[model samples]
Target: MSKRDYYEVLGVAKGASERDIKKAYKKLAMKYHPDRAQGDKSLEEKFREVQEAYEILSDERKRAAYDQYGHAGVDPNRGGGAGAADFGDIFGDVFGDIFGGGRGRQSRARQGSDLRYNLEMSLEEAVRGKEVEIRVPTLVECDTCHGSGAKKGSSPTTCPTCKGNGQVQMRQGFFAVQQTCPTCSGKGKIISDPCNPCRGQGRVEKTKTLSVKVPPGVDTGDRIRLSGEGEAGEQGAPAGDLYVQVHVRDHHIFTRDGNNLYCEVPLGFTTAALGGEIEVPTLDGKVKLKITPETQTGKMFRLRGKGVKSVRSGAVGDLMCKVEIETPVNLSSKQKELLEEFEATCTGQGAKHRPKEKGFFDGVKQFFDDLKS
Candidate 1:
């Protein structure tokens, strides 16, 4: 008898995907299986033909040979097809795909989740670095059961439902499928006597205090990672990590931009007119700031190497100070008279001493003259 084409027997196209071939084979196998056929000889013969077709077509080497030479390429009678052991391997793979495992298989364990903690630090502490303690509430491994979830002097036993396989196979109509054991919950073990503290959970919620060392020049949004400091894993698995997020508090004296520091320095009126050395505050200490004669308000002075030194690159930044001249207030009668006489002498000198004030009045006079015209 001439054998039919494998694709024709399976009722699938020659260019069909592996998945399509498997699907067609499964449907035909279900219809012609000997158990479903109930001892009918013809149906049993058809079942054998279907099995043979699947065995040859499912194998890459055999399928390739069969595609080129037809039935002569894979003749089971001529010892060219798969042997009994090879057939067993094929059956194992197909059955495993349909009804899951038949041998020993380990269940997957869960790992702990990572955690985050926000840390607030003062400007001085952020620039200089400091060690701080933080309290975190998380799950910790139970000591009574040693993370086994079993009571003292007791241990977990193999689940009778799955027989320690952690999975159970069920026959459904024409297909068999495997699922996690309901009784064991896929753990493959049963804890009859649970621990008193964790009550079979193997872990407990507790608050832990840990010390975190903040590095110098750590800006806001910087994170310090601490390994194995997060929540405890299930059944003594590996612990997760803890990330400490840094947040620097605002400074009252200076505003920091990257590594540079900016501040407003109040300059006395006499100092602005006559010019002299004034003391200015820096991160290191006070520095003498020399003011030029007739220095105007809002004049900026740059003091190099007086700002923050970068922790990453170790580069020094400058401190920029803006001068704001303060006007005299609460003058006595004699002081006011002396100021009026000094002002009169200064105005008599024209725009020599007060060029800015003279320019402002000159612009106003031009504006009125233009409006009259």
Candidate 2:
């Protein structure tokens, strides 16, 4: 029986690109696969036919020869025993993901994983910056074997089972299954005389002391990176980095937002009623803030350049001090009498000195009148 055209079997035009042919074959393969269409002989035969069609049409040279002289030109039975080119193309498409059996061997020397250390700092320390010492547990190179995993004079030997391939393949019913070598566990070598210090591993677990310089104006959530301070990799691979994550402690006197500092300053009634200068605390030192006459509670005063300078940029921010007027407590009888006399004199002025209180009373009266109506 004459064979069908390869392109027509795969349902692709002769001028179709390699990608188009692969796409059409993949759809047919998925649809007619024996696993998907169980016990269906017709579908299984269709799957094999599509696979054979793709095997010929997907190759440039074989496709050209077949296009010129038909199937007889490139047939394996025609004295040209299955071409090396055709075998490689089929194997690559089928089993490329199996073990280290691909084109190149996988790299043995892998870098270590990055580590994070939470560091809590006082607000003052975070704002001013300081050198902090942190102890981190990490893997360091073994002193005895110097990261070779071998004894003083001896070294590791190639695995007897896999012969340094680092992988072993097993034939499983029409498919080759590749897995890590059981003897070497994929290392491809075995150490006969292991180091006593690190025991067959090239690294030792120990606490490492690192000095990290915290930059000025670093707020919470800022991280400082210390290069090559993390765990050491196996067989002299490159070490990972150490990240110091900052956490600023709550301050009793101040709260910070970005570069700005905010604080509440309590003032006596006399200082709020009759203007006075009071001392306010800043990161640098104490600064005097002037309060004008009749200063009310919740009044804010800004002192320029008294806040922290940003670490990202050197721009300084202002300190905002909010005033909270303190009423007199523990008053004597004489003080109470004197306050009453002063209140009486103020009442005689008829709400002129207390415009806010007078407006509040006016609103209250209007509300009651509207309710009665």
Candidate 3:
């Protein structure tokens, strides 16, 4: 049968994004997987088709060729029949569960695992980025062996068992099952005399001190990735990355929401009644904010561009200051006398200024009147 168009096989448009193409292939691969379909040969053929579609579409160079020249561009061995596609690595990444190999077959030189470090920062430090030193424990390549498990004078030799394929096949009934070579441990090589420093692992456990540069406006749960700062890989594999997770400490003055900073500013009763300017604290410095006359509690005043700028984008946010009117405590004799005189004047106003208190008393009077009726 003639080969189907790569886009048609994956059921994706020619202009599909990389993410869209991968998503489409994942769906088809899961549906037509041989393990999912038991011993069905038709499903196996469909699975191979989906795999071939993904193999061509996922690669940028291959995708370009396939888009321009169709199958003839990618197939070097054209008209020689469809050889088993390089499904070993691809299947391991996608359907490792069905193959009983989690991350596909592990290479002899595998990249180190990625590491995460939680970094605690003060609100000031988070607002303005700071350089911090942290200690992380990870595997480092042995200096003595130079990443090779062999002794100083000797080198590793190829395994006698399974030759150098790293896998050994076993026949059960009529099906052939492939498993990692027991003797070689899938390395396909054996070290006769191990290095004295790292034993046979070729790496050592050590703690390293690293300096991390935190950008301005980074909030909690934000991550900064440092390349090649993680654990050292075995043999000659590339090192993984280190992720620094930010955890901003709670501040006594301000609470942050995204880029906006919110703060509760306490005001004297006199300031609330007769408007006055008060000094309000901000990340930059203290600024004077004017309170309007007869201002009630919970009134908010916004200071534009006074808050933090976002880390992803440089957009500045506003700082919201909420007024909390504070009542006076510990009155002197003269002050008490003046307050009492002021209370007498307030009583004459008939609760017009205190509408909430007037409403409560009006409700109490109606309840008594209802009882009498």
Candidate 4:
């Protein structure tokens, strides 16, 4: 079969720039890659064709020779072109861009993993702030070898298979494929004499005591970051961060929304009707809340500066107290007779004493009379 033009195979112009040619070949390679095309033999053949075209066109020397003498000039079968190693290196770069896997030496120093600690606090503690000590079990640098992963005097050696590159390249038809070195597991180095305390991991599990300062007004779901407090990195690299997740325990008296606090306060029937002052609890201390005369149930009273101050700002919120009137119960015989005598005085004063009840009964009577008519 006759071979197609290098430019035509990549769907690029004959005089296209190197960048344009690379972009065209990348699109074709990603589309016709064997892994992407499954087991289709025809697409695999097309992929090889695209790879061959890119190999010749991407190189200045090979491209010039091919332009002068056509396929005969750069054909490997004809023994007129660059060596197989040269093509492998070229395709390695192209494949590296398509996949994140690179052709260069990989770093062996791995960063530690970040950790989260859920810290529960009482409502009073959260509002007022406190500093407490926490015990965490995590990986720390091994003291025996000083986190080197090798014995006291010994050190890690470069991988012989990959020459410390952490990767190996293989020639597949007209393309070069790069993969992690199997011998050293892509670590680039091997620890022959493992550390006694941490085996070869360079870290050991231990419980660490850390002091965390809880900021004022930090509610549930808030986080405080403590840098370098997480798991120790491998082989003495920088440690990861520790996140302190705040979780406020449920309060018995108040419910917090943002910086504002809400609570229900029960009022005696006489105290609500006659008006009086009652004590309410706040994070600072107890304060007097004055109730107005003729106050009904579900009346809300706002106390300024009684709620939490914002952690991020200086603004203070108010406390909203909802009052519910409590009716007296379990009365004695004399008390019941006194309440009956009081009710008899109020019996003919429904419009004055119980206007809401009178209006409701009047609405019910009007509805029934209209239904009958």
Best by lDDT: 4
lDDT of 1 by residue, 181-277 (tens): 8998877888999999999878899999999998788765456889989877776777777878666666789877767889999999999999999
- lDDT tens per residue, model 3, 1-373: 7999889998989999986886686567657766577999989999778767776787677787677667766763431112235434444444554455553244365567667787878999999999999999999888888878777888778878867666666666544466778988877788899889889677888999999999999976566889988877766466777888676777899988778999999999999999999999999889989899989999999999999998888999899999999999999999999999988888857577778778899999999999999
Give the range of the ten consecutive residues with the poorest summed lDDT in model 3.
78-87
Instruction: State in Å the error of residue 79, model 3.
Output: 37
Estimate, for each residue in 1-373, the C-alpha lDDT of model 4 and write its tens digit. Answer: 8999999999999899986886687667667866667999999999888867876787788898788778866865433364455456556655863565655746467667766776878999999999999998899999998888999899999989888887887776766666778998777889999988899889999999999999899876566889989888878877877878666777899988778999999999889989999998877788999999989999999999999999989689999999999988999999899989989999889999888999999999999999999
Backbone clashes in each candidate structure, one number apiece?
0, 0, 0, 0
Question: Per-residue error at 32 for model 2, in Å?
Answer: 57
Ranking by lDDT: 4, 2, 3, 1
The lowest-lDDT stretch of 10 consecutive residues in candidate 4 is 77-86
**Candidate 2 at 21: error in angstroms?**
48
Worst 10 residues of 2 by lDDT: 76-85
Error of 2 at 338 (Å): 2.0
What overall lDDT goes with each candidate model?
0.78, 0.79, 0.79, 0.83
Q: Mind giving the per-residue lDDT tens digits that candidate 2 earns over 23-48?
A: 68756765776666689999988977
- Compute each candidate's TM-score over C-alphas: 0.62, 0.68, 0.70, 0.71
Candidate 3 — which pairs collide? none
Q: Mind sharing the TM-score for model 2? A: 0.68
